[model samples]
Each structure stands twice: as structure tokens, then as C-alpha cells.
Target: MFTGLSAFPLTPMNEQGVNEHEFIRLVECLAEAEVDSIGVLGSTGNYAYLSSEERARVAKLSVENAGNVPVVVGIGALRTRDVLANAENAQQAGAGGVLLAPVSYQKLTDDEVFSLYETVCRSLSVPLCVYDNPGTTHFHFSDELHGRIAQLPQVASIKIPPVQNDLAAAKARVAGLRALLPSDVTIGISGDPAAATGLLAGCDAWYSVIGGLYPEIALALTRAAQAGDTEQAIARSAALEPLWALYQEYGGSLRVAATIAELTGNVSQPCLPQPLRTLQGEARKRVEAVIDMLSLS
Candidate 1:
């Protein structure tokens, strides 16, 4: 049920490992700012890197700290049964809804992918938002496949990552998909920079990572978009351009969370694990310089 600005909090970790205090503090700060909602244990939260026990702890603390705010858990995995199990856990933990990404890797046929989602749809009690992030998932759900899954009663929203870089093409794709689906189904646009673009195009909401680190700014831009104030939205989004630039420098999606931890001073060690590459030396200095330059808070 999240619409405007939903901040996806970074799951704080220390040198010794899990940093519950840091996580709590960040959540508290975001809550105080009154973001539209909080998405716990999403891609930004590094759910894939966490153990089952760690997931439970993070999910529980995230829910507890969120209080009355709507919190959606990202229940995603490489297999079917595990995704369903995670969904059940999220429901038990009192999440408002779930953002379910299709199984990453293993390129499946349309029928196979539809069947996987069908199982999750039938099992989860809360509403489901299908997350379309083909960049990492390997399998991009075609319009026909999306239509097939859209028939499920639990399907509440579609979080499209704007698969095609061309804004016009993206709009066409989203429009075509929307035309096939029911009118009430919400379409949430991912890719933060294009949030305003997506809003102008007819998506119901914007799923954001940058919003986690800068709730007020994100909210301001989201509000402007909702109000159809293009000039205001552009100005607000532009203010965070430097932060977005830093994200691009670091490589993949993990940089989004890592940058948030760096700017906010929440996580003890924001570096990614071995082989994944960590920011140090010149790289670390450049990242820190950008942070100092932006004075992002």
C-alpha cells in the first residue's frame, strides 16, 4: 500500500557483524522524517548476504522500529520453496506487504516463471508486488508473462525497473503492460533518477533506494511529482545528482546501500565482502570526497 516516497533502509552491519543499534537509529531517523513507508530487507538491505537467523532478526527489528508505518519485506530467492518460506516468515513478522522478485539465475520458460509466482500468490496472505529487475534476475518477465501472473488475486502492484534505457520505450512497455492488466493494479517505477519521468508516464508509485538516505529530499520530489509540478520535481531530484553519481562509480546495486551507510554513518563497515570489491585507498578517498562535497545528510 505504499505510494509516494518509500525509503529502503540499509541493514546495518559492524565489524563483528550485525549492527542492530545502527539499524534502529536509521529507522528512527527516517520515521521522524515521515517517509511514505519503509521497505525492510530489500535489495538495499542485502537480504541475499544474510543468514536465515540474521534475516529473522533484521525483519523483526525493522518491523518493531517502524511502529505504525507500513513496512514491506522483500522476499526473494533463487528457488521456489525458499521464497515461499521467506514470504511466510515476513507475514508472521507483521509486514504490511511483500515485494517478491522472481528467482534470479536459471532462465525459465514463461510457464515455469508463472508457476513459480502462482505458488507464492496462493501461499502468501498479504498482497504481493512483483519486482521486475531483469538486470540481475536474468529472466525478464515478458508482457505476456506479466499478464499471466497479473491474473492472480494477491497481485497488488508491479515494480518495473525500466528494462529499456530509452524513456519513451520504457513508457511504451509500461503502458502496454498496464493496458493488459486491471485498472486497480498499481505500477511502481524503480530506477530513482527516472522516478519523475515514470510519474509523468502513469506509474502509480515510485520504489526508491536513494530515498533511504535522503527522506526529506525524496519526499519533496515525490510530492512535487504527485502534484504534477515538473519544475519543482526536477530541482529536488537534481539536488541529489552528486549522490547518484557516487552510486554509479561503485558499480552495482550494492553501492546504493553502501553509499547510504557512508553518508549517514550508520553501518560500521560499509564495504562489500571479498571478491565483490571494497572501497579503499584512492577509491575510498574519492567516495569520501564526494560525500564531503555533497554534505548529504
Candidate 2:
């Protein structure tokens, strides 16, 4: 079900819980833009920062606001039982599917990863997308482990964030994974800036951040790449390079905060969990410059 640009909408928060009103406005914008899918509670959604109850509420809210678009809720938690709980709630909230990642404080092994996914999958009737974001999870999956997870029942897709952004290198990686994965299983690219490269190389979707704020730009870029319009695709994605550089320089959390702030102003200012600061100094200035030039006017 994941295809084109899947907008990873941010869960903008202040001291008082989720700021539901602001969150609603953001989802409404995405619905109006007609993004391919709305992925709430992803790392971009700050799933780790909210409680299971809070996440369930966000899932239900997204579905209500999403209109014709599919809503995939992230169900990554530190414990297996917690993941199961999150999945149960998401299914109950009428979510189209669930995105899962091995969010761990302690390092996890292949067997452990398989069992966690297996447990969560067994409890739900909805499709599951394996979120392979090593930067957040700290659990890298070998090709062998990735293949094993793809075999699980109800598993429909794998979202891969490439270690390197080089087009040829990214293509080789997608080819290797495509060979091991079942023919029906979709390969999604979350390595944003490399997304054009990945889509050009045959990935089925782009799990995106900018799409959350600028879906029109995102879809145009996706269409270009999908139609083999190499120059258009590269140029469109290249226009996003400054923001991508900031995502690399700071992190997704910081840069995403900056992007949303530009989109919706101070209400969208980030309130990450302890030890993580919002964008400041030159980082914030760089985000403003990129947003000024590239954000929808």
C-alpha cells in the first residue's frame, strides 16, 4: 500500500501533551495536498516521546483527518509487549497499517528482532512495514536478517534508510535487498535525499519528511523519477539539498522541527524529550534560508 511520497508528519508538541489543535491543522494540510499516505507516530512523529494511550489518540485523529489517504501508525516501542499493545490500539483506531522498528536501549540480536516482529504481527490483522532506520534504533539488519523478517505473515514492505547516499551505491543496495525479498514485498526508501536515486533504481516508495510540509514538491519529484525523467527528478530533489544537509548536520528531529516551524510558525516549534535541544544558532538560520527558497509560498 506504501507508494509515491509517504509524508512523515511531525508530532509538534509543547509542555502540555500533544497540542492536538496544532497537530490537526498539520494533518489537514497533508490531506489537502493529497499525499500518497500519512505516516503518523514515525520517528518523525516522535513516537518514543509519547505514551501508548497518546499515540492511539494521535492515530485516531490522523484517520479522522486523513480523508481518502491511508494512515499508517508507527508502533515501535522498547518492549515486545508494548509494541503489541501499540499495534492493538492502532488496529482498533482504523489505521490502514502499522510501521514497526526495533526501538531499543539495549542492543538487539537477529533472533530477538525476529521474535519481536513475529509477536506483534501475530496479534494484528493489519499489514506491517519493517522500519529499518538504524540511526534511531541502533540495530542494524544484515541481509540475512532482513530477508527473515520479510517472510513473516502480514509483512508487506520494508523501509530502508541507506547508509550512503551515492546513487550507484544506493542502487546496488536496493538490488541486493530486492533479490532476497519476496517478489510481492515492496521496498521503500526513507533515505530522503537519496530517494530520487532509490526510486530511479526501482524502490517502490519514498518515506519522506519534506513531503509532510510540501507534498506538491514531493509528488512532482516522484513522478519525474517514476517516468524516467532523470533531469527533472534530479533537479527537484537537488532543490531540497540544503535542508537535507541540515538533516545530516543536525538530525531529523532538529531539522524537522525547523521545517515545521517555517510551515506553521512557532506553534510547530519542537519539544523533544530530555537531552535533545531544538534547532538554534546557525542551524536555525540555514533552515530558514532553505525554507524561504524551497517551501511552498
Query: Largest TM-score belongs to which candidate?
Result: 2
Clash-forming residue pairs, model 1? none
TM-score of every candidate relative to the true structure: 0.91, 0.94
Worst 10 residues of 2 by lDDT: 253-262
lDDT of each: 0.76, 0.82
Quick one: RMSD of model 1? 2.2
lDDT by residue for model 2 over 123-149, one digit each (tens)?
989899999988889888888888998
lDDT of 1 by residue, 103-171 (tens): 666677778778888999999888888888877677777777777788898888888874354457767
Residue ranges of candidate 2 with Cα displaced over 4 Å: 253-266, 295-297
lDDT of 1: 0.76
**Residue pairs with backbone overlap in model 2:** none
Candidate 1 regions with alpha-carbon error over 4 angstroms: 14-16, 163-170, 270-278
